[model samples]
Target: MAPRPNIIRIGMLVYPGCLRSGAVMPFDVFHIANTLSGLRVAANRVHFDTCWLSARKEKTLTVGGLSFHPQPADLEALDALMLPGIDHQGPYDLSPLLLGLGPEQEMLRRYAQTGKPIISSCSSTCLVAEAGLLDGRRATTSWWLAAYFRKRFPAVTLDAEQLVVEDGNHVSSGGVTSYLDLALWLVGRFGGDALRQSTAKVLAMDANRSSQAPYIAAAMIQDEGHAVIERARRWLNQRLDRTWNMAELAAHCHTSPRTLLRRFQDAAGMSPTQYAQQLRVERAKALLESTKLSLEDITGRCGYEDVSTFSKVFKRWARITPREYRARFGLRQ
Candidate 1:
């Protein structure tokens, strides 16, 4: 395509149930970028004009109960579009919001066909998935809803581990707060790497955050209502400090190893060995966050024989070292 125009027009789509921050944070970032661009020479400046658009012209209430009125705009004329996540407690809470967007799917599909970028953050990726644009494409959403999203849209490849997934003209971000990263990334895409970095520094955002792993809670992986899985989970939780043996664990759960593997995978989306490892890592995280124990002590308590092995495993699961995880949880490094 032709070089991106000097003047970029972006439209933010807002509905009654949209998250207030998600709807306005991008505007703030672009506004900041525009303010910064004013200081540069003409050749180095990038201009962004953003409009908040909604299907209805009347006043709308945000999920947080704040009143908002979005201006009417032409989606076809804009160079790009953004879909902020909706605020909801669970998948069922989103049913009404998703149903409300059913009328706009055709328009959204035509817009996607034009190949103009459509950026979605968190739960709003569901909107694009509903329009079928994400079919056979890699995408992500809030980490807590990964299993639900996968079940809802089997055609899309859902990787909740990613902070952002850019496939063709579709860019998706994970979690609610990732809209900041998404906004900074857009700045890089439109302006340059230097502008992106400067904006991140001004905003105090962690520029190196690329994975959702660090933020995922251990409880999210646990599935309830399966007797075999629950038994295995209880068994593993009680023995996080011990070396895992699949046959022994299977026997303890009162099932054959093959049956145990199949049932565990069906329930937890991972094999028995992987589940035990994650459980141990999660225990390590808990200890790191709550205890004043040294790394060597924590390692031994969490099943690892040495500090080095524990640190490596912890980094693999949490995407940060044990020390970093401790620091993040409010302990001074």
Candidate 2:
């Protein structure tokens, strides 16, 4: 028998004030991929060795109110180093952490020299910029901090409108939710589209939805109509497992069914029913990719009344059968 390939080691750097969402989201996504793949024989086995790297071994608090203790290792051994965002008030807010990052920065610089990937999200993009890794590179961050980032690092081109920006070995994403997009991209890059599709499916995300340009532009434009569309989207996202009808959705949005249909079409470029189905299909994809649950269970959980109907809808939307999609993207059962 052949020896198992080495698992990719991902080092997550958690500091005293790191954002919990930024640090934990990627970990959860990758772990789900590992779980789903392990259930089948032919699936590409992904071993994710996550170590929390800190300047000290003392207990640290996360911005989301979680406390953790990390290993004190030099960052050299990591296949990838993730710098989570911090809520820094100004330049002074980052000095302490930035001061101690010389060793970490050195490791990142060496990794860049060797063509390894370096990822940062939200305010963490500042760390990469400060390290001069993004000089003359296009990157992005949370819109609120875009101007400051451009001012602080004049050589780096900032695209505040993009959810995630990839420049060679460096990847940066906008806000907390955009971390999902960045994680999906990494899965696609290293693990292949099957893993990427599976991870996105598990997350209930739309792989067809470009994480860049028009989608981001649509998200940024906030008007009264946009607010209504957003409210409808939130309602749908929260009730993916429940059967949703056009009348019920219209009532929830305080409009007639026809008006709701027209507005939803204008806002999201799809009918409300179509939008709901899209969301369901996205959820179904995630379930298939991340869990060992039976097809029946996934269909029910994603609000399908019957497996036949569910399979048909999934195939129509995804352009492949669920089992085939799973086999292509996941390890064979």
Best by lDDT: 1
Candidate 1 accuracy as TM-score: 0.91
- In model 1, which range of ten residues has the least summed lDDT? 55-64
Candidate no. 2 TM-score: 0.57
- In the range 1-333, model 1's lDDT, one tens digit per residue, is 333337878888877678889988898898888777767767778888888777664665355666666676577688888888978887656657788886456667877877899999999999889888999999999988776677678899988889999999999999999998888888888878887888888898886689999888766745435788878888889898887788988898899999998997776778988877788888877787788899889888888888888788888888899888888883565
lDDT at position 136, candidate 2: 92
The ten-residue window of minimal lDDT in model 2 covers 214-223
Per-residue alpha-carbon lDDT of candidate 2 for residues 1-333, written as tens digits (9 for 90 to 100): 644534777878777567787778888888877776565454366666777776554666445568766776555677777877876665346657676667556656656675767889888888888878999999998765654565567799988667778888889988667777777776677676887788789889875443332222223322233666887878988887897687778888899989988877655556877777767777777777777788999998888879999998877666677887677565556
lDDT of all predictions: 0.82, 0.72
Clash pairs (backbone) in predicted model 2? 43-331, 201-285, 201-286, 202-286
Which candidate number maximizes TM-score?
A: 1
